[model samples]
Target: MNRRLYRGLREAILEGAIAADTRLPASRDLAAELGIARNTVVHVYSQLLAEGYTRSRQGNGTFVNASLPDSFLSSGRRARLAAAPQPRPALSPRGAAIVDGASASPYQWGAFMPGVPDLTEFPHRKFGRIVSALWRNPPPDLLTYAHGGGLPALREALAQHLALTRSIDCDPEQIIITEGSHQAIDLASRILGDPGEVAWVEDPGYWGARTVLQANGLRIRHLPVDEEGMQVPQEAGGEPPRFIFVTPSHQYPLGPVMSLARRRQLLAVARRHGSWIIEDDYDSEFRFSGRPIASLLGLEPDAPVIYMGTFSKTLYPGLRVGYLVLPRPLVAAFQAAHAELYREGHQMTHAALAAFIADGHYAAHIRRMRMLYGRRRAMLVNLIERRLGADWLHRDASLAGLHLVLTLPPDMDDLRVVEEARARGVLTRPLSRYYADPALRRPGLLLGFACVPEQDIARKFEVLLDSLAEVARKPARAARA
Candidate 1:
């Protein structure tokens, strides 16, 4: 990277390709365009400065020197390195797998685009006021690396909140704050699992969880879900999995609450196998109807479960706050491991969040959003049921979460529909990509209603319907023969 940048820049100056005193792009801007680090560009600029190829003003930016000698064109070693043929960059197999397995969407904000909450509804003014107050006279500890897993106040506040809302009873000491649920998953995978150990993830499950586990070298085992939720084996056949990642409250993509019997079964099997049940209770809040289900961790005392929760869905993704509630025995291990790996310290944000929760702002906000999302979800369902038909909606898919699965005909191509829909301005995710087993992939779309406005919902639905119109009219069992 340096050789290319350095050579091209100096050659341009020496050949008078770039006129004298021409200001170059800012380091950050150049770095962004080149997809490289800003520091890398700065390093290149420094070299040019040292070689009298460029000059810099205090605040103006780097500029081509007004006068540079002609002798610099024959600058010995650099000429050879720059002229040498450069091979394509290579990545480790694990690194390439992580990229191939990635399912995150860059276009997260739009109608029917899944997994993003409506950030516009967040109490930015109130939350900002609290955050601003902290920075007025920020404490020194807030800026330093924190050895503590998290600020005690925030952990305690979360502990109380979970106990009341989700029926998860855990001490504040069991909580480990992380940047987000992904980081929490990574930490859990690293601490609880060894390479090549199995991690049983739900089929058509949350891809992010699987990607993180796979990156950590755990072989993935896809377990199918049904009306009763994940179907774990009766016993650990041979070797038990080191990790079992699940969303028992409301299964992702496909919706079904893990039945009481299944929950009991999972607990017993995990215990027998000495497996760690990683419960990702993400978006447990905003249940559209009835009381939310109790967490898997609470079903049995001393259940080897690590409860992972996040503020991304409840609050906003940019908040960068998620936590893990470990079993009593795992507190020390996770706390130490998290601090060592992530260096979890966000004193000001933690303090502000604790205050927000303690003072009831957090609860109050959820109450409002719960009602808001309920209306939107109902509206989307009504529109679909009226125009398309009830058959299209997954009747068993949980009524909770920011998105719901819209089932398509077996002959329909969900990936093609998604692409066409996106081109027509209706963003959605193809259900086919969520499955680890290619054979198990279903034809469906995950339509997110949480982020879309109520007035715009119908308009967006019409656009999406147009995209599906092509396959909607075709025969389901047409044969090429």
Candidate 2:
């Protein structure tokens, strides 16, 4: 009898017939109605409360548990009801747009996939040892919420390293450690620009940066990029933008080091317009050519440039550690904003990274990977020229960075070719998809050679080349028909 009563009540709750928080009848009234003793009703109600199906208030009557799990209430009948499909709630306009424009690949690591480091080569044993030691004897401060702009030890180490290598003139105080360059960009966009304000981004630029700016409600103005990097607008036709995004060190996808004259000209434009420059120095450490180009921040010490760098390319992406070097005046505001917004904390990892840099392991690892990647880059270029033929596709003369852009015929659909190539197990990003304005986009493929093994490069290129060759033949075949 109790089993029958319990099952019925549970089914009602799970099926939404008896909505959450609905009070059950008094024990006397229920007992009389069901033709059962009052004690029987009390026992059943007590059992329901114990099993978390319902709750009881001392003064008031018993009620159904608002937070009861579906599994707890589900019976033979309720199980069938649970399987019924329900309509999903509508997403906001911005949310829907973000979902529609999603470009992240399902698979991260493979041949020709860009911006991924060789994780197998990472010194995990050394890092693990450091982590183990720190965990065994953890400091009070290390376990607490991080404040006042990242770990001091890591900041100091980074300051020394950046000064020595990138020629960035900044103290530890001016550096704000973040989860990655993505967060650094988000923080900068929020603090620097307001909703509906103008922001300038390179036409065929990093899509990630463009997405961040757009998500912050900033109106993105697509500026064309040439061999000298982003072309600074000479004449002020309209109102100045709040900020300008650039990858000057090694221009993303289509790698072009911004010339000294162009850098000065860009600075002049920014100064005249009173717009801040967001310089993303991602993957600058992997330069295989002449002397490394100094950062724009270093060129003009007092320039309004927020320089960002991430260890994702150099170390591993999972580290989720990156830094932003801001001017002295903007440091406090950024620090406060970072704290209020992100509240980032990875003290142990930061300490380990600091020790790794200070002990020379970080620099040593970079030197090893640089040599490995250089060979890989040359092999890929050689294969493209030899197997694919230079007449059909022109490889961008990029002396640095992990990826190279191969320009296709103006009439070709790079996106369609990329989709077909993915079917053949060769991953490549279509260059046209990176542009904010589709009308201004050029047909090209961004091939990443850094993560691919030396031996696998030949085989992978064969697959990619075949797909591209087939694609090239399509238009000709159509014309002949």
**Candidate 2 Cα lDDT to native:** 0.87
Model 1 segments beyond 4 Å from truth?
1-85, 471-481
lDDT of each: 0.89, 0.87
Extract clashing residue pairs from model 2: none
Q: Pick the candidate with the highest TM-score.
A: 1
**lDDT of each residue in 359-408, candidate 2, tens digit only:** 89899999999999999988987876787566534434567888877888
TM-score of each: 0.84, 0.83
Q: In model 1, how many backbone clashes occur?
A: 2
Q: Which segments of candidate 2 are over 4 A away from where they belong?
A: 1-87, 391-396, 473-481
Q: Per-residue alpha-carbon lDDT of model 1 for 1-481, expressed as tens digits?
A: 9889989889988888988999999999999999999888999999999988889999999999877865555565578778969886798999988777678888878999888899999999999999999999999988888876899999999999999998888889989889999999999999988999998999989999988999999998898888888889997666788889999998987878999999999998898888999999988897898888999998888998999999999899899999999988888888888888887678889999999999999999999999999999999999989998999898777779899899988878887788789899889999889887878878899999999999999999999999899556544455222
